[model samples]
Target: MDELVLDGNAAAGALAEIYGDDMTTVLAECASCGRVDPIGGLVAFVHAPGIVLRCTACATVMIRIVQTPSRTRIDVRAKRIPPPPETAR
Candidate 1:
Protein backbone atom coordinates (compact mmCIF):
# COMPACT_ATOMS: atom_id res chain seq x y z
CA MET A 1 0.00 0.00 0.00
CA ASP A 2 1.04 3.53 -0.56
CA GLU A 3 2.10 5.58 2.40
CA LEU A 4 -0.11 8.44 3.48
CA VAL A 5 2.62 11.01 3.79
CA LEU A 6 4.03 13.90 1.86
CA ASP A 7 7.23 15.91 1.73
CA GLY A 8 7.46 19.12 3.82
CA ASN A 9 6.73 21.17 0.76
CA ALA A 10 3.15 20.02 0.99
CA ALA A 11 2.67 22.34 3.94
CA ALA A 12 4.15 25.31 2.11
CA GLY A 13 0.84 27.06 1.64
CA ALA A 14 -0.04 26.95 5.30
CA LEU A 15 3.48 27.90 6.29
CA ALA A 16 3.56 30.77 3.84
CA GLU A 17 0.48 32.16 5.50
CA ILE A 18 2.20 31.97 8.84
CA TYR A 19 5.71 33.11 7.99
CA GLY A 20 4.84 35.61 5.30
CA ASP A 21 7.75 34.05 3.38
CA ASP A 22 8.47 30.93 1.38
CA MET A 23 9.45 28.51 4.10
CA THR A 24 10.10 25.65 1.72
CA THR A 25 13.58 26.94 1.06
CA VAL A 26 14.41 27.68 4.69
CA LEU A 27 17.14 25.46 6.08
CA ALA A 28 16.57 23.78 9.41
CA GLU A 29 19.25 22.46 11.69
CA CYS A 30 17.76 19.44 13.38
CA ALA A 31 18.15 19.57 17.14
CA SER A 32 18.21 15.80 17.46
CA CYS A 33 20.70 14.84 14.73
CA GLY A 34 22.20 18.17 13.70
CA ARG A 35 21.42 17.65 10.03
CA VAL A 36 20.80 20.84 8.10
CA ASP A 37 18.47 20.83 5.13
CA PRO A 38 15.70 22.77 3.57
CA ILE A 39 12.38 22.56 5.38
CA GLY A 40 11.02 21.10 2.15
CA GLY A 41 13.09 17.99 2.66
CA LEU A 42 11.34 16.95 5.88
CA VAL A 43 8.55 14.47 6.01
CA ALA A 44 5.06 15.87 6.38
CA PHE A 45 2.13 14.17 7.99
CA VAL A 46 -1.14 15.96 7.40
CA HIS A 47 -4.22 15.06 9.38
CA ALA A 48 -7.54 16.40 10.51
CA PRO A 49 -6.12 17.88 13.69
CA GLY A 50 -3.05 19.51 12.17
CA ILE A 51 0.21 19.11 10.32
CA VAL A 52 3.41 17.53 11.61
CA LEU A 53 6.80 17.89 9.95
CA ARG A 54 9.54 15.47 10.87
CA CYS A 55 13.19 15.24 10.02
CA THR A 56 14.05 13.03 7.08
CA ALA A 57 17.30 11.80 8.60
CA CYS A 58 16.37 11.32 12.28
CA ALA A 59 12.59 11.30 12.12
CA THR A 60 12.41 13.85 14.92
CA VAL A 61 9.46 16.16 14.89
CA MET A 62 10.41 19.52 13.43
CA ILE A 63 7.13 21.35 13.66
CA ARG A 64 3.48 20.96 14.55
CA ILE A 65 0.61 23.17 13.51
CA VAL A 66 -2.89 23.00 14.87
CA GLN A 67 -5.72 25.25 13.90
CA THR A 68 -8.90 25.75 15.88
CA PRO A 69 -12.01 27.73 15.33
CA SER A 70 -10.60 30.68 17.20
CA ARG A 71 -6.86 30.15 17.13
CA THR A 72 -3.88 28.55 15.46
CA ARG A 73 -1.02 26.92 17.31
CA ILE A 74 2.43 26.21 15.90
CA ASP A 75 5.00 24.30 17.93
CA VAL A 76 8.57 24.12 16.66
CA ARG A 77 11.55 22.17 17.92
CA ALA A 78 14.51 23.56 15.98
CA LYS A 79 15.75 26.77 17.60
CA ARG A 80 16.87 28.42 14.37
CA ILE A 81 13.67 27.59 12.60
CA PRO A 82 10.91 30.08 13.27
CA PRO A 83 7.43 28.98 14.13
CA PRO A 84 4.33 30.20 12.47
CA PRO A 85 3.37 33.76 13.28
CA GLU A 86 0.70 34.38 15.90
CA THR A 87 -1.27 36.41 13.41
CA ALA A 88 -1.71 33.30 11.29
CA ARG A 89 -4.98 32.70 13.01
Candidate 2:
Protein backbone atom coordinates (compact mmCIF):
# COMPACT_ATOMS: atom_id res chain seq x y z
CA MET A 1 0.00 0.00 0.00
CA ASP A 2 1.13 3.52 -0.73
CA GLU A 3 1.66 5.91 2.14
CA LEU A 4 0.31 9.42 2.15
CA VAL A 5 2.91 12.04 1.48
CA LEU A 6 2.85 15.63 2.69
CA ASP A 7 4.84 18.82 2.36
CA GLY A 8 7.45 19.65 4.98
CA ASN A 9 5.09 22.24 6.41
CA ALA A 10 3.19 19.38 7.98
CA ALA A 11 6.05 18.88 10.42
CA ALA A 12 6.43 22.56 11.24
CA GLY A 13 4.74 22.35 14.61
CA ALA A 14 6.85 19.45 15.79
CA LEU A 15 10.00 21.03 14.40
CA ALA A 16 9.25 24.38 15.98
CA GLU A 17 8.51 22.73 19.29
CA ILE A 18 11.85 20.99 19.29
CA TYR A 19 13.92 23.75 17.72
CA GLY A 20 12.16 26.73 19.27
CA ASP A 21 12.51 28.40 15.87
CA ASP A 22 10.86 28.45 12.52
CA MET A 23 12.89 25.62 11.09
CA THR A 24 11.01 25.59 7.83
CA THR A 25 12.94 28.60 6.64
CA VAL A 26 16.29 27.00 7.31
CA LEU A 27 18.24 26.18 4.18
CA ALA A 28 19.38 22.62 3.68
CA GLU A 29 21.55 20.94 1.10
CA CYS A 30 20.67 17.49 -0.10
CA ALA A 31 23.66 15.18 0.24
CA SER A 32 22.58 13.04 -2.66
CA CYS A 33 21.45 15.64 -5.15
CA GLY A 34 23.40 18.67 -4.04
CA ARG A 35 20.23 20.69 -4.24
CA VAL A 36 19.69 23.47 -1.75
CA ASP A 37 16.29 24.49 -0.53
CA PRO A 38 14.45 25.53 2.59
CA ILE A 39 13.24 22.85 4.96
CA GLY A 40 9.70 23.62 3.89
CA GLY A 41 10.50 22.57 0.34
CA LEU A 42 11.30 18.99 1.29
CA VAL A 43 8.89 16.15 0.95
CA ALA A 44 7.41 14.81 4.15
CA PHE A 45 6.13 11.48 5.28
CA VAL A 46 4.26 11.99 8.52
CA HIS A 47 2.30 8.79 8.94
CA ALA A 48 5.25 6.84 10.24
CA PRO A 49 6.47 6.69 13.83
CA GLY A 50 8.22 9.97 13.20
CA ILE A 51 8.41 12.75 10.66
CA VAL A 52 10.70 12.03 7.72
CA LEU A 53 11.77 14.93 5.53
CA ARG A 54 13.28 14.14 2.17
CA CYS A 55 15.01 16.14 -0.50
CA THR A 56 12.66 17.42 -3.11
CA ALA A 57 15.14 17.01 -5.93
CA CYS A 58 16.29 13.47 -5.20
CA ALA A 59 13.89 12.18 -2.64
CA THR A 60 16.77 11.38 -0.31
CA VAL A 61 16.12 11.35 3.40
CA MET A 62 17.34 14.60 4.92
CA ILE A 63 15.94 14.88 8.41
CA ARG A 64 14.15 12.50 10.71
CA ILE A 65 12.50 13.72 13.91
CA VAL A 66 11.12 11.32 16.44
CA GLN A 67 9.57 12.14 19.75
CA THR A 68 9.64 9.61 22.52
CA PRO A 69 8.30 9.81 26.03
CA SER A 70 11.76 10.05 27.50
CA ARG A 71 13.44 12.16 24.88
CA THR A 72 13.19 13.68 21.43
CA ARG A 73 15.47 12.24 18.79
CA ILE A 74 16.54 14.10 15.68
CA ASP A 75 18.72 12.75 12.93
CA VAL A 76 19.82 15.43 10.50
CA ARG A 77 21.64 14.11 7.49
CA ALA A 78 21.29 17.20 5.35
CA LYS A 79 23.97 19.84 5.25
CA ARG A 80 23.14 23.37 6.28
CA ILE A 81 23.60 25.88 3.48
CA PRO A 82 24.54 29.45 4.09
CA PRO A 83 22.49 32.13 2.43
CA PRO A 84 24.03 33.98 -0.43
CA PRO A 85 25.54 37.35 0.29
CA GLU A 86 23.46 40.31 -0.66
CA THR A 87 24.83 42.67 -3.26
CA ALA A 88 25.02 46.41 -2.66
CA ARG A 89 21.92 48.12 -4.04
lDDT of the candidates, in the order given? 0.80, 0.79
lDDT of 1 by residue, 19-60 (tens): 878999898888999988788888899854799988888888
lDDT of 2 by residue, 1-89 (tens): 15588888988887776675778889899989899888888899999998999998889999888887876667778898332223200
lDDT agreement of model 2 with the native? 0.79
Clashing pairs in 1: none
Q: Which candidate tops TM-score? A: 1
The alpha-carbon lDDT assigned to residue 68 of candidate 2 equals 77
- Per-model TM values vs. the true structure: 0.84, 0.82
**Candidate 1 — which residues are off by over 4 angstroms?**
83-89
Kindly report which residue pairs in candidate 2 clash with one another: none
